[model samples]
Target: MFRPGRLQTAPNVWKRALSNFESRITRHETSSDDKKDLILTILSSTATKREARNYLSKYPLLKENDIYQSHRRILDSDVVSQTSKHDKLINDLLLKHSARSEIQLPEPPQKPEIQLSDTLRVALIRIPTPRRLDPETLRGIALTLRKLVQLGVSPVLVLDGKHQIAAGESRLLTVNDFVHQCDTLIQALQTENLQARTVRGLFEQENFSLPELLVVPLLHGIIPIIFPTTVKKDSTEVVMTPFETLKCLVSNLCGFNEAYRRNNANDLLTVEKIIYLEDLGGIPSLERFQSSHVYINLLQEYDDIISELYIGHLDSSVRDVHVQNLTEMNQLLAIQPAATGLITTPAIATLRHGTRTTNPIIYNILTDRPTISSSLPVNLKKTPQLNTTVIRRGTPLTIHLSDDQPDGKGIDLLEFDRQKVIDLNKLTHLINDSFGKTLDLEHYLNRVNGNIAAIIIAGDYEGGAIVTWESAGGRRVPYLDKFAVLRKLQGIPGIADIVFKSLLLTYSDELLWRSRKNNPVNKWYFDRSTSDYCIPNTCWRLFFSGSRVRTLDDLKGYVDVCSKIEPSFV
Candidate 1:
């Protein structure tokens, strides 16, 4: 691991220096000494530059002018064929600066336009371990990988697991550790998204870079490779080493004949047929840095990798249970793919199939259908028909008022269509079961004004809302005081979706609600909410859908005051 003792200068300062030098270089016919001085000044390390100049002076062919010209030659080369030479020259400069403990790393290649290759199936590349990567450097790496993947290259990143394990040896390897690492990678990839979003959250703004102008050379016909690592041998058993496994995978991916390789031990593989894998520590020397674009492609890839594996957003215990289930299922099926020796989901298979979109599998999951599709690698014993009707149609919502008779002569709660009045006691019974607690019947009736209600069907409330006005920011905001459905109807396809959509359509403009932090349904609430707040020392997270809570102060005040209300469930 190369420990860079001191980090490079700020990006702005580097850009300013480059800008100044470019203007100077174009206008002036400076002397050789003047040009050398400018190079040293731009490098920002006089001592290191002097030593490098002395070293280059040893060769008669390497003039001061030639050294200056080399930098221009590198920046001008527009093809991947010429990158290797430029890479070596830059590495030589970096190594010299490393020795001196002062190096200003070059700015990322400017806006490298990606073009998908017709032939390459996968391009295996390495990235720096998390600690060494700043957001800019990480963005550069992600953009490069995305370009490769866009060009029909399946980028299988080889992270430095050995180093990570060694660094945290005292701490045991757990799912949390893996999750943290994945989150870091995902955050790095989301640099693009972080910049593009309109609202700049406190942390998001500092960690990600905004887009900048750049022009990078087009990458073509470059198949960079590094030797694979070796594993220990067992005396009694024959096992494939890591390198052997890698070679076999390469052979398979490139369609190399195993028989031909077996007959000749020293058979040289063609470049087109071989897969390239690089060490994370060495990738810097091989490629130029990158700048992030506003596109969300890298974030999508990160989501796909984690979600397809079913590891994202899961706690350790849940992940373990899932893995155990998979293990048992795999044993029962007796089917394992050569790639990972595990049963693959349609979502994962879609990624490996080189398809950019996992919409088919996603559509299946969203519609509450099976997580796999007919396109999965393993053939199922029975395959269901593609569901045409994921959503169950429902009658539009209606709000109805109770019979306005004095002295409590009319019903307190009535159906939306006003065809019949709902028995408050029956409504309480159903709500108690749905909420897993006795409904505060008196408080609920009072909040509903003992008259008006929003209901799905008029005869009896299938799903409904009982709301009251709350004065927030000097406005009568409709607070969703209590919402419930019959326990039997819960999770029935489109029951909640249609009911909520209809309710929102009725009161399209401003509403507020607070859900218990522990509620599983909070995810649904959060998704619909335009703005939200999590009050400290409280169980409820208040959410607002409309444009009422415009200021942070108002939002905070509303959430803090509303969350203090006594537990509504009971």
Candidate 2:
């Protein structure tokens, strides 16, 4: 977080510095010394000129809380080609700063983007020990694994032994207990006609090397189960901690390994997902005062969340486990731009989880989306608890609220929109692309001309909102005129959630919007809305949301906007 005393320079002076930094970074004319000065200036929070404003409310007049988030957003949302000079420079610069400051950078070593030659959609699945899982849970896990295989998602299981016992057979309990567990799960998978093989690799000391021939099994459609055991210089195999093994494997798979660097590995394996089946469940939080985070943008929330967990005063063992899960999750996502990770209970991963029919692991692998949106309102969360938390290499969000101006005078959002201050063309592109229809831009302006309230945009227009003021009688309602996310970004975990979160926080008063009765996103709207109505004589369902009770005037305003609003689509 941005601390108050970090930046002593006047805010206006920093503004000039920000302009200079922004202009110079992209220009060939800029000198290296100037860029270094710009980076050092950003080490302070209050003077940050970062564009990732969604999580920070006091943006522009930045607080101390924005530094890590700003740098992370830059890294995670970088759209430049990995092989490009621009991408390399950005990565190098950020890394140099992070290392100089000894800051825990969120990304793993930047790896080459998945190659076109790679044919396998491999997932690294971390499964619980057989001793820990009941028979029913084991069966459920088998079935889920079967489905993944049928869908062409090759599963590489990371089997961990009992935490205390490092090596022995599964007879009673020991370190090598994972061997028995791995065998048991393999047997169950075979019963369902899923081919699985136990894979034990020799890790040379601390340096992580790819197990010789692990890729061969994946190529032939056989599941490879990796044991978390490493060999010392004396050649003795020691069962390392589960995450210890996972860290090594993640590095190898992401091409941060000797094998990959030598062109022997990472040719066939494109790690699509890293599924961690935790018996305890997702990272516990205090959302309503919370456990599962539903979705985590590690780039934005990791440090803050870790700090929260350490201070949460929960059970030490459970907290450690949750923290470790997030630790691996961060590395897993940092593997590549399209990398994804899931941490859910064995029950949620294997059997039915709440109202969802699809397994969380399978669901994420198939669609690259959370089973439930993270941006879902607290009241609408149907699942008893958010058992499954899906994570993705998420995009950054920039939230600009009309009511945030100081001196008691709000910025002219109306003029801003008209002047394309919010990048009207890109916002229009988002609406058009997301809705899959051509927008009558002129007509849209004519309808919401004076009603435009706020426009929230994410990324370079990956998702956005155009809300308006709807009036009836003497009352005005905040109307959600349009909420859209690019189709490509629909599966992204945090995009919709952040968009919805911004809406709720920005409009604390009763906000109203309507959707076609059959619109696919109505459920999202209805879940968050306080009350909803199926407007008579139209194919629209009117929705209202806020803490305030709906009065006759509020109702009138909501109904008028929901029922009378004109469509802006061509």
Candidate 3:
């Protein structure tokens, strides 16, 4: 009854063996499901779609559409709802399994490395785009780069190809590479650093290379040129031709006829007619010449007669006739002052008793002049008289004169801190050194305080030199050499008036004389004295004498005289 390997020989025995085999196969199939579940679990844990897809690929039974649908169902259904009961169970199972073991993943790969060539190393110098860099940062970079070059080190140059700076870079590379025979090749590198918020600052920082200055044609309008088309021997028939030929004739005439041709010759015929008239005693009653064109035509027809008149062969004798006519019309306002029904003011008497300083005289004249009150609109029978009572007492005066030192020794002292005896040549050098670039001292000296009475050039070891003096009106005159300062104080803005008033505050004196006779420091006489003598003591001490006065007290005697003469002097 019991047969081995037979399906039905021993019914119980066959059943047991078949059961064992079936159990093994069932275990193998279940193991595959476990692997699938593991993968699905991993995929579910993923944060992105790609990871989920990779996880699904491990199980051929898993479809993307199925998983996507499941995901949508999970998102739509609530955990407590009957529709999501299966999903909740599956999710719980996956979470339990995932908590049992930890999964290890690989890290992301790093970016590729850049290997620079030896040629590129020598060629590449770091050139930051100035437009993209802050002004201070660019300046610092330039300084550092220059320092590095000075130290014989070359760095890489970074550039933005899309900019006007490309031209400059090309020029620089050409000069540094081909011309110099040095390998200064630039390598292009893509960078976000080249984008700047403000480019104007870069231009103002003076850190970038500039292109050569060139003048390009800027046409505004067409310019017309006229010339003779053809010349006839008989000189009567007119000829017409192309405008170019006329232009050529004009150019030729301009080059050849230096006496008659002008760059702006709009009325050439009029000028010719005037010349002809000048020769023939001018046009008689020019007002009667109704049409300018007719007059010019008549002048052209009688050209020979006009030439004879120009050569002084005419009966009129143009020069004599003009002279006689001018003499006869001398009574006209053109030749003489108009005699109107108004009283003219005579010159006021000059004040005699005062310190007789030339500056005081000029100052007094400027102050005492009559104010024109009737500069108003309206017809009035009576004119305003000059107010003599308004002539306030003259103020004390101070005159400041700014003069360059004789030689550059002072400037040398400023730089080297050494005391050196300076002669005229050395002083000239000093002045040139100080202001040679923007200004010249000799030209500016006579311009400032043109009424300066005296100048003192004091030597100092620490300060190099100090120029101190009182300006007219006793103001402590500050140094004003720069044209900018002069423009602010003396030009259109009216700042000069305020400054002059401030100067008058300290220098006004009533004793200051208003007459040239009372003022001894007149320019003509002082200049003459200075020119005639160079001895330290022979001429005026403040002027010719080279003696050094240590204090303001030394100038007291001169100041007293000026003060006594002009009460306006301070």
Candidate 4:
């Protein structure tokens, strides 16, 4: 069907066109349209399909071709099935026309690489309603569908309305029908494709396998669907998330959800007291809510001085109000349980409720609020007093993890646990001495129960630290949850140093913790730390030891998680 003589005369035509095109360019005497048409004509007359393909590849402007027509003519000739030579020429022409053009085009996409395994990869197609579908959107969706088909992905489409056509042996079903049987869509597709070869053979026998003459109507307000020719298999790896980690996250989210749901009050208080003499103020707004009733009862206990302090005196000047209220409030907060309980009640409650959930939304809600211990007491007794001096020189002090309850030869070292039942009052007293006030005991317990190895207590509980495993960038490492020493025992030579050394030696791995940026103890922490960084606009300074932080991306994940935690110590 390919005439060799007709092709052989192409060189003469190309030479004439080349000379004319060059003359037009040199003289600037021809329009761009005329020059392009002339070059296209010369290229079409090439001596062979190879020459035409090579010529088009080199110039890359003359792109149109009648390769499909040529292919059809060859297959319909007396030499049909023996027309490999003609077929090759038509394929080459088609490839050249499709591959080379004035406009640059990317390479044709290939199907996703998949192993020839027995496992199946599920594909889902979300069907959209036709009432509001646009022509341009339909075209884009069709193109994506074609790509999916080319990749051997036969997605099970969910139809929403009645359909009239039969796509070979494929069946259409209503939304309700599909929804009821939706779980079986993958099995159906796999079964259908598995028998594709047999169905194709039947069609060939019935004389319907050949290309047929049919008019393709313009596609509009319709979804394009593609069926698979054969069953497809793809390889995938599965991973399981830790239950403890998920539980922790959900608890945090639930606490915040409850906080917002229970209280609609703003964070600022109705009344604030500032004292220049003491350089102190009443507890934070959340604390005020927690202790409102307690503070009112305390005012009645000290009723003798109420009139002098203008307690409930509405007509007093703003200056008088500040002078009187500030002094009384400061004195009330100085009392042991009252000040400590006010600050720690909500934190402990929130932590307790937080243990019941691990949702990401709850985690996000919790992080939006300030952590419990971001601020410190303006006044703390510097001269420490010990209730008992039990340790002697060279006393073998061992650090052991507490297993749910305190157990060891020196369990008495943790004085707060002497009551046997670890309750809120004991924890409050413990924190009031160690930190300036009490902390959220429930939140601390949850962290301990979920991820922590144990509570590391020193001899007779002179000092201790909460230790846990935390994941960052998928790598789990040791994290220090809380560290505290009895106020009186602090600054004693070898008291804290031995506990620190023993714990570090025991884990022998990377440890991470955050300290308040301006805390006096940070100087000691920084001296022993391998690395430390102060976060902007926050009071926290993250510290790490035993390993080098790797990439900035890795550091970012660690920072984001740690920064979101409320101050764990008061």
Top TM-score prediction, candidate number: 2
Segments in model 4 whose C-alpha atoms lie over 4 Å from true places = 1-392, 395-398, 401-428, 568-570
Residue 12 shift from truth in candidate 4, angstroms: 99
Candidate 2 worst ten-residue window by lDDT: 108-117
lDDT of 4 by residue, 147-196 (tens): 23222222223222222122222232332233333333333323222111
Local distance difference test, per candidate? 0.38, 0.65, 0.25, 0.36
- lDDT tens digits by residue: candidate 2, 115-171: 112245677888887778888888888877765654446678887555545344553
List the candidate numbers ranked by lDDT, top first.
Answer: 2, 1, 4, 3
- Position 274, candidate 3: lDDT: 4
Instruction: Tell me model 2's lDDT, rounded to 2 decimals.
Output: 0.65
Off by over 4 Å in 1: 1-362, 365-391, 401-419, 423-426, 450-460, 568-570
| lDDT value, residue 542 of candidate 2 | 89
Of models 2 and 4, which has the larger lDDT?
A: 2
Question: Sorted on TM-score, highest at the top, how do the candidates line up?
Answer: 2, 1, 4, 3
Clashes of 2: 18
RMSD of each: 25.7, 23.3, 40.2, 29.6
lDDT of 3: 0.25
The CA lDDT at 450 in model 4 is 45
